[model samples]
Target: MRMAAGTEDRERGADLAEAAPIIRANGLSVYYGTKQVLSDVTLDFPSNKVTAIIGPSGCGKSTLLRCFNRMNDLIPNFNMTGQILFDGVDLYGPGVDSTEIRYQVGMVFQRPNPFPKSIFDNVAFGPKINGYEGKLDELVEQSLRRAALWEEVKDRLKSSALALSGGQQQRLCIARALAVHPRVILMDEPCSALDPFATLAIEELMRELSEDYSIIIVTHNMQQAARASDYTAFLMGNEERIGELIEFGETRQITTNPEDERTEAYITGRFG
Candidate 1:
């Protein structure tokens, strides 16, 4: 039976409120040199769930996602203020190793970006770099299975990743991220580059993965956010081009009964 939207929202809210957050942001802000992109954004990403960040273009959705693993550090002159805590540790604290943080919080790009190596090699790369002492072949198979791509590519593990279809390659990328056993996975519009069937495949994979890994995705697709995520954060930019979190809550409420009128307007196609 289909539940009423309010009933679903209330149930989900109660459940999520009790779950411990795997990552918490406090007064988070991002800047590229002199330009501020994200301003005073704060939110909690609960463990073993999918949190989707949705906003119009230039709203810094991707910027906030990169802050999780400190990917923004790679960009020159990029800086931030405030705390991004992972498992109670400040990500930007002194002596923190960005490399280790990245291993714990892996990222999947918008496009499928598998290396020019074979399918087996693509999945094995991370485990190899992180110095996995166990059997390499087993880890590769396990990662592929977790990404829901093992059956299709088991026979062609040696084939070049480029030889696979677009969806297969994206799954291969996901399998690569899983090989490292990351606690949290951040995806930036993971389905934006795929066909409808491929997009659905990724969404299904996300649902299954949430059982073991906390997933955070930045997406512009409203319907996708409504369908795939457990929680939704709506962000909007001000006149000065600084993005801020306007509303955040269970996906059902955020989509059906957003507390902020701006969020409702954007979701209803009135404006972005």
Candidate 2:
């Protein structure tokens, strides 16, 4: 029997609380018109934990993040064959709605891309589309507060989103994502373009959000991953790489006494 989104999310939450993966990927592969950007890959993301995917450039980290929300569909000629299950439902099922998956699994990109519209409009865009009929003003305020952005942008809700500083704009984007209340949040190099202070602000916000949201971040910054994540997945991108899974343990172990030689080399500044 098909399950409603709410029921599915609840089931996934309970299963994860009992130590199961909320999202599981198996034999995942991707092709950009047969270039085969990503080869056979498998991984599982447990809920409510900060899981960071770290890898060198072109290592398929971002490609893998896109798979969770199916954002890869936007790229022309992109194709994939695999299973990405959320709440025990395969997102690639024949009749599944890609839009629905996006609603449940929101994403934040490397550069903050706020709408040219007002700040209030930016946060309300998603809710409006999904037919949010409740008190929207309250929702926007609550989401901003959760993103640690209300205090900074509360008085300027009517101002153009472009008017905000870079850091504030990124925070606004995060607030916008939080407003949608997705079960899982996919972040792709979210801090790559931010200043140190802005980066720190985002890290703190992610830590706080993990209490109520399952967050997966792809970061090239090893220290940032170590500092912000509860668990880390180090990936090496190459033909022989097979996206090597260096370590899938606590942030401390992966950062300190990692069992994999490659992991030690990367963390100890041997190579990226």
Candidate 3:
């Protein structure tokens, strides 16, 4: 039998509190050039769970997700203050390697961006570049299988990844990320460009993936967040008009009984 939602949330919270957070943001503020994009946001992401970051457009949801892997460092004028910790290690600390961090924390973009290479090659690329000494074929097959794309593409492993349908290409990209054995997967509007059927497929895949990897997704779709995530974080512009986290809690709570008026407003369609 299923437990009541409140009981489930409390039990889940108790269990999570006993474990260390897989990722944490402490007073994180981000800026480009002179304009601050995010302001003093702090939160923790539990391991092996799906956490959705939701907000209206231009609210720094993507910026916060990118910070986990130091992706913002690539921008010319990007700067941030405060700490992002992964497995308790400061991601931006001295002696930490951003390249290795990215390997552990993979990203899937808004649209399918499969390489021009064949499907087999795309899945094997990361492992090969990392000097994987295991059976390459088995590794590729395992990754594809985990992504739920192996059976569909198994017969045509040598076919060009670009030739696959849009949904298949996105799954192939997921397979590529899994090949690296990443601990966390960050998806930035991963379903924005897909059809309804394809979107459903991805949502299902995410639930399955959370059993093994931490999944943090930035989405503008409230329905998607309510349906797919275990936890939700609502971010919006503060009085200063820079993105700041308004409320965060179990998905049920955030969607149904948000603590902040702003969060309620955004979720209830009163205003973005």
RMSD vs true structure, all candidates: 4.3, 6.0, 4.2
Ranking by TM-score: 1, 3, 2
lDDT value for model 2: 0.82
Candidate 2 residue-wise lDDT, 1-272, digit = tens: 21211223433334334656668777687888957766666666877888999877777889889989989989999898878898789988889999989888989889999999999999999999989999999999998898888998889999999998888888888889888889899999899899999999999999999988889999999989999998777777666544534445567777878767777888888887
Candidate 1 vs candidate 3: the lDDT winner is 1
Lowest summed-lDDT stretch of 10 residues in model 1? Answer: 1-10
lDDT of 1 by residue, 1-272 (tens): 11112233545656666878899888898999999999988787899999999999999999999999999999999999989999889999999999999999999999999999999999999889888999999999999999999999999999999999999999999999999999999999999899999999999999999999999999989999998999998889998989988877889888889877889999998997
Candidate 3 lDDT over residue span 15-96, tens digit each? 5576577998988899999999999888888889999999988899999999999899999899999988899999999999
- Which is superior by lDDT, 1 or 2? 1
- List candidate 2 stretches off by more than 4 Å: 1-18, 240-244
